[model samples]
Target: MRQSGTVGFWRWRRNPLKRRSDVVEAWVLLIVAVLMLCGLPLAGVLAGLHVDDELQHQREERQRTTAVLAEDARAWQAGRYARYQATVRWKASDGTEHTAVADVGPESRAGSTTSIWTDGKGELTGEPPTEAQAASAAALAGVLTMGGAGALVLGAHWVVRLSLDRHRAVALDQEWARVGPQWGTRHA
Candidate 1:
């Protein structure tokens, strides 16, 4: 009962048995706990906000336009994207026309219409992510930020633990140096 109840007694109680290293380590553990609980979530929130802002900027800058395949293009893969590739032509805001290779679906054929995305220069580009995609990306960013912050704090805690252990070892060596000589003069 005594051993189980005294688990953290050295850290929580004031006694001659509590060395300076013990006190420092206890304070460090408390700080780490606070940071892991508070700072990690804060980092995740900040990262999510940042991702949303960037996605919004992209949504504002990119434009969707109608394009036509210059020739029949077959499916490059059976997936949603890159189902096919073909020379696609679209008009710019100034009525200038441009051509670029584009990913299309199997339904595309010569002279058939399809929607495409373009940049400020009217060059073909990938479409901006939908609201769902933006939200998913934000969520992923938040998770990654939290994980990275946790890893950093955990590493710092490990370093602090190692430093405290080294100090404890040095203290033990010093104490033994003073008491070691007394053992030679003892009768027993």
Candidate 2:
């Protein structure tokens, strides 16, 4: 009693049986499609760019300095990794000496020198990420942003569809109740 391809756009086409809820659902679908296809990707790109800029600024504020071990470092093995912690002394740009415990290689001796990173105030800090690492982080942030936004959009769309379906069901029940007695009399 129905055509195959006609079912695709029935909500958009003119039909006596189509309810106002159907038109609302169609518009919701159109808006969701536009957001998923365009808005989400643009948001992801902006997030990536912001992350990359922040990381680059931090990298510029760090510097590497040579540190000499103040005490002998005994290597300790943890699973397949081995490292030693020893007190190290390093001079800042202002000729002030600073000492801190730092991780060193297993073969390091008391007088051996190793490289360490420092902040603008000559405080020891972690090494700055390389260009490739920063890029990877930015890409990961972009992907996560896109995935999160997509999920939220899909969740909202699902909620709207469910509400519309409920509305249609209620309307159908009301119509059937009004028309049921006539059908019963005709059958009798």
Candidate 3:
């Protein structure tokens, strides 16, 4: 029921009741605050940049190639997104012909031309991420990495705080053991 008074003033106030643990906890909090402020955003940005570079590399590897349909795709379906898998043929940069199954609109027919992505080996591959997609992916990666950094920082803080609490408890126990037997010695 005592007055708790001001918040962070515990670190500055001259009070005999303040233990070593209180000062250490305050210092730990200050260090953690500084680190979190600098570390989290930096980690996020660095991770995003690294991921963006990787995405760019992948985009470079994937190139758009015009392929002719080797076989007719199914007739157009009523759904908005109605694509089916069918065979396609394309010539590689080395003038080598390759055939692979690709996703195409249902309305596409055999001998029709369609553009698809191919790797350097002329193998069909998924399309590369666009600019907006890359940005989104980078943001997601940044957020995920930032969360990981936060967890690591918080975990360290928890360990330090627990250690301080344990030390405080041991000190309290030692003090009480030394002074506990003097309670009834007022007349002695």
Weakest 10 consecutive residues of candidate 1 by summed lDDT: 74-83
Location of the lowest summed lDDT over 10 successive residues in candidate 3: 74-83
Rate residue 43 of model 1 by lDDT.
94
- For candidate 2, the per-residue lDDT at 18 reads 81
Which structure among the candidates has the greatest lDDT? 2
Cα lDDT computed for each candidate against the true fold: 0.88, 0.91, 0.88
Question: Residue by residue across 87-114, what tens digits does model 3's lDDT show?
Answer: 8999999899999888887778899999
Candidate 1 lDDT over 24-105, as tens digits, reads 8889999999999999999999999999999988888899999989988876776655568888899998899999888877
Best by TM-score: 2
Compared with the true structure, what per-residue lDDT tens digits does model 2 show for residues 1-188? Answer: 88888888889889998889989999999999999999999989999999999889879988999999998887655657767888899998888999998888877889999999988889888998899999999999999999999999999999999999999999889999998878766443
Candidate 3 TM-score versus the reference: 0.73
Q: Which portions of model 2 miss their true places by more than 4 Å?
A: 1-10, 91-98, 185-188
Residue 41, candidate 1: Cα error in Å is 1.1
Q: In angstroms, how far off is 1's CA in candidate 1?
A: 13
